[model samples]
Target: MTYVFNMHDAKTKLSKLVELAESGQRVQIARNGKVVVELNVVAKKSRPLFGEFKPLNIWTSEDFDEPVQEWIDAFAISQSELELQSNKK
Candidate 1:
């Protein structure tokens, strides 16, 4: 979800906003309803403790690595929710 706040509100709720941003939400701090700054979760590089799993490269179909439709739908739903939240602001 995207969160919107004015400068004062953003400052006052900095901690809470950070917590939300850490959870993959976008936050926009506005001045007079004009967006000034945005906070978002930064993508982190992931490392396995032991090592990375090697791909077998045995898949036969071109769509083998494609995301399932259900997952795509879920993502779409999530995006829609974020858009809705943005509209509210």
Candidate 2:
């Protein structure tokens, strides 16, 4: 649920508002009667770095089979065709 507070009330009760926000409540601070800012609680999760020290391998078997120029020409042709179709519309 969202808790709405005017500017004065929000400033006076800042600690209590923070406590509520930390407990998963959305706090809206309003100037006069209009909402101006919002405070949200974001939960962060821990991630494991299992592959941090893995060796990098750039060369593959396919790289030897196909020339780099062939891939670049194909990509350029497709991009031009896409641009032509978009311009028609």
Candidate 3:
């Protein structure tokens, strides 16, 4: 549920309003019957700054990797095959 308070009332009960908002209540402050501001509780969970770190393997061989040109050629061939099969349907 939300509660609306006029500017003067909100100013006078600022502390109480903060307490209510912190307790998951939504509060709207209005000036001259127009809403000026809204207040609500926003819960935040803190995470660990440093949980885990993995070491890098800099001695990996580049010869075991597939060449980019070969992969691109295989992709083009597979796409052409798919297009041929679709056209035959």
TM-score of each: 0.46, 0.48, 0.50
Candidate 1: which pairs clash? Answer: none
lDDT of 2 by residue, 1-89 (tens): 99999999998999999999999889999997999999977788777589866688777785576668978999999999999999999
**What is the alpha-carbon lDDT for the whole of candidate 2?**
0.91
lDDT of 3 by residue, 9-86 (tens): 998999999998998889999999999899967678776578455667779677767678988999999999999999
TM-score-based ranking: 3, 2, 1
Ten residues in a row with the worst lDDT in model 1? 50-59
Which ten residues in a row are the worst by lDDT in model 3? Answer: 47-56
Q: Which residues of candidate 3, in runs, are more than 4 Å off? A: 47-89
Q: Looking at model 2, how many pairs of residues clash?
A: 0
Between candidates 1 and 3, name the one with more favorable lDDT: 1
Over all chains combined, what TM-score does candidate 2 have?
0.48
lDDT of each: 0.90, 0.91, 0.88
For residue 2, model 1's alpha carbon misses the true position, in angstroms, by 1.6
Per-residue accuracy of model 1 over 53-86 as CA lDDT, tens digit each: 8867775988889999999999999999999999
